[model samples]
Target: MNPTDLSLDDLDRAEAEIETGKRGMRFDQIGSFEPNAPSFLIQDVLERDSQAGVIGDSGSGKTFAVLSLAACIATGKPFAGHSVAHSGPVLYAAGEGRAGLVRRFHAWAKANGVDPLNVPLYLADRGAGLIDADQIAELRAAVRKVAQLHGVPVILIVDTWARALSGADENSAADAGQAIAVLDELRREYGGMTTLVIHHLGAADKTRGRGSTALKAALDSEFLVARNQSSTILLTATKTKDGPTPAPMAFELEDVFLKTLEDGRKVSSAWARPVEYVAESRPAGKNQSVALEVLKQLYAAQKQTLDGAGFAGREALVLVSDWRQACEAAGLDRRRFSEVKASLVDSGKVFLEGPHALLDADAVSGAASESGGTIVPPGRRTHSAMSEIGVSDAFGHFGQNPKGGR
Candidate 1:
């Protein structure tokens, strides 16, 4: 063949190679690269092959908490008491202000004794909007190139998903679903690396995340960082695929200096509040018996024909309040109160009706007639005399113990 003809064949061969490369092969038994500390006492809230969402209200430190996790991964340190499987370079695509992030990173690195330069942290330049899939893909490719050159895995963080989404109205479920789909795709493409997406919670309650339920449903894990008492940040794991549930973590902000100055330099000092799990806070004192009293009151008020759903709806709160008062009057602990409430509920003495607690009307009327205008104490057996007399005159009677005594 002539030289030019051979060159043409070579070009064809190169094109064929490219096409084959583009068609990636799937691996059957992908090796398990579990971390040395496979399970984190706290971080069990997240696991390998799982996607997680971190959400909070505005100024709730959601970004800071996730950033802390990123820092820990890059430094090979444990994140919120959970050991990471891998650590290396990290990519932080800041959708907000860049200068603010730079300052924050500097302070964090200085406080934690981490060398900012050695951290291998990269920030996307402004105008490179992450909302576009193509832009995100380009960014991921660049990160992979850097990782390959440096010989380390990279964790990608998309701060504030509101800025990373395109073609979706922030308020609509359809739009949010599309945004989340794109994020899932990104995560699938970079299976080896951990991707943390920061989001916001809605005004309703903990279950309602901002934008749509699709955001929460799509994630393998979801965390909420809420501000408590205005000064404390409470980090709660709302959902996790790895385990039952994780204990909440609490943190308090304090000042810290970034560098030491020789010429009258002042190092900012702030309290270092290491992240730790907060023990469950049960209702105390009078509130301990709230559930039980609520159940009892519901049963008493609704009588024999009381429906569980309706009682639960209207009188549940009142029952709870009365129970709390009863607890204070009777001096019962929270655990005991909970047990009593559970027992009463199981016994069917009170029916719960959509937040309302209703008393069995038949039981109440029978007790009233037998006891001669007295409220019937719950779970008391009716007397033989009362059974023989019948409850025909019980309609007007009230305040009778079922045991046949006032």
Candidate 2:
């Protein structure tokens, strides 16, 4: 057994045998791909090891949405009316701002009448810093220990992949891929415990994550949050491996806090409004024409620069009222103003600037504006009129007439 006496061939044979022995004892078949397993909707298959990527543009409520999901799971409450299959201890690795997270979690728990401290929840005491492989290993060990002590499986929530990954530049595809691979291995090692990694959407494509394609390619499921239709936050399932796609859910943030009951219990709560998303439709005939007038007025009021980023101070109600008044004055149905605004927005005639809807600034102010801002209201234009004059041609004519004469 003397190491110095062993030949090179002998050492190679011995190493190979050791590896074979290790493989024989390993559970390599646990996650082997199966083609015939029944595919269930994400809502249907509730208990399984899964990983999901929740991404969004800044201020799109990605964090809040995921926090809401975590809260729902923690309380065994339905998430956006979707059923919950399991309620267990959860671990939130808040690497961003601890104080903020504390406040948020407290608010969520209080609002839901759940005790923040009593829940099987754990926060990493590790201070703010880059997470390396050592930290990842430490997290794995800590999670296992917590699960064993609490007798409940842990859902590890890493706030942002950029902060959680150690020694890997999140912006670099190669580095991110390697780092994510490590995370995936950790998830596999844990026998499929749920691991949710919050990440940022890229500036170019708000739907795509910031890192390499590999990040999205390797994930089991993915969710994208964005402002859709109205000011409501839209949560869409972009990818799913073993379940049906979850329909896009909308929500609005109301408030945040922690509350102490009349008794001695402390709970976290978050005031949120669930938004209903309806398909946009144009009003009929004269109502559509009035809607056009209202949009024109709003555009004229703003000097014609309208985009989602503008309209910061106005309320949607106020804008709707203004539209109603303009429609009434034009002898159009005031009741259809909201529908008209929604239609214009959907049609791209009116741009959503945050909460306010107004005509597109570039479109109306540039060559399109040459028609003196005149636009045929939806539903009012006859098929013959539409066939005689296209939108661009009509706008061109309007542009030529600064006064917008018929």
Best by TM-score: 2
Cα misplacement distance, residue 304 of candidate 1 (Å):
20
Worst 10 residues of 2 by lDDT: 385-394
How high is the lDDT of residue 184 in model 1? 62
Per-residue lDDT of model 2, residues 1-406, tens digit only: 4569999998788788878785324456756966555322225433357666887877787877877777777667777777766677777777777776677677777767787777766777762133465676777687778878975553667788777665567767777666666666656776646777888877554446786777777777777776654566767655655434344577877675465789988755344455664433434355565566545544443332321324323221114344444455455554555566545544445543212334443434432353233332322212221111112222321333212222
Model 1 lDDT tens row, 14-113: 7787788954445565466544643331245556545577888888777667767777777776765667666667778777867766766676777778
Q: TM-score for candidate 1, please give it.
A: 0.57
> How many pairs collide in each candidate, listed in order?
37, 23
Alpha-carbon lDDT, every model:
0.55, 0.58
